[model samples]
Target: MPRRTGWRVCSVPGCPEFSDRGGKCDDHRREAEQRRGTARQRGYGREHETRFRPAVLARDPICVCPGCPQCSDPDSACARPSEHADHWPLSKRDLIERGLDHNDPKRGRGLCGLCHASSTAREQPGTFGLH
Candidate 1:
């Protein structure tokens, strides 16, 4: 069943805290980050930092979430400046599995910090206590 549109208890199995952001509460969120390790450890390497990320950001200077909420109209592209070069449609892991260059700028879109965090929390495995 789909979760209702409101705050809920923390996603960590026995935790009693509440959260309105990612499913995990603050403590679990911190713990999960510690477990997840650094960006380099997760495969974001020098090529990503020096090439892919900059290229994507230069190509898309604004947030590109469909119907981005940062704009006055939720049906419009966001006016907020982009802060992240995000992998899209195909996740980095998916691209690698398919033998495509995971750091290709064409595989990414620019997103504001808010949009990036929201999408990461929602879509990334092991986030929100799913793993």
Candidate 2:
């Protein structure tokens, strides 16, 4: 087994705790998650879990991001399995305000967890740069 080593300062802006996790320390991690709210609070309720998510995943069993290309091109796309059903070209809030079905599978795309997190951090305001 590989050894677990290395530590960095906690990412809570002057918290002054060295963490092997690369983000917040254990004490602060829980606090951060609580502040972020639960999945239902974030609008991923039953419909999203049961209908929209399953359909999108079925349609795209693999990551569809440009970085995860399916062709022979090496620098095109990823080969990671899809793990998230993401809203494309619009967020759930944007769809709702426009009187659209926010959970419609037609408006979703499949992405790997890494791709989804990266995309979310880049596209969603106030997600990054606050810390």
Best by TM-score: 2
Q: lDDT by residue for model 1 over 13-124, one digit each (tens)?
A: 9999988885889888989888777788788899999999999999999889877644568887776899999999787778988999988899999999988877787688
* Candidate 1 clashing pairs, residues 3+ apart or interchain: none
Pull out the clashing pairs in model 2.
67-77, 67-78, 68-77, 68-78, 69-77
Per-structure clash totals for the candidates: 0, 5
Instruction: Tell me the TM-score of model 1.
Output: 0.72
For candidate 1, give the lDDT of residue 74.
80
TM-score versus the correct structure, for each prediction = 0.72, 0.83
Please write out the lDDT profile of model 2 over residues 1-131, one tens digit for every residue: 45577998888887998889688888899887887787887778999999999999999898888853333564777667999999987987789889999889999999999788877877785663222
Error of 1 at 93 (Å): 1.6
Q: Worst ten-residue run, lDDT, model 2?
A: 67-76
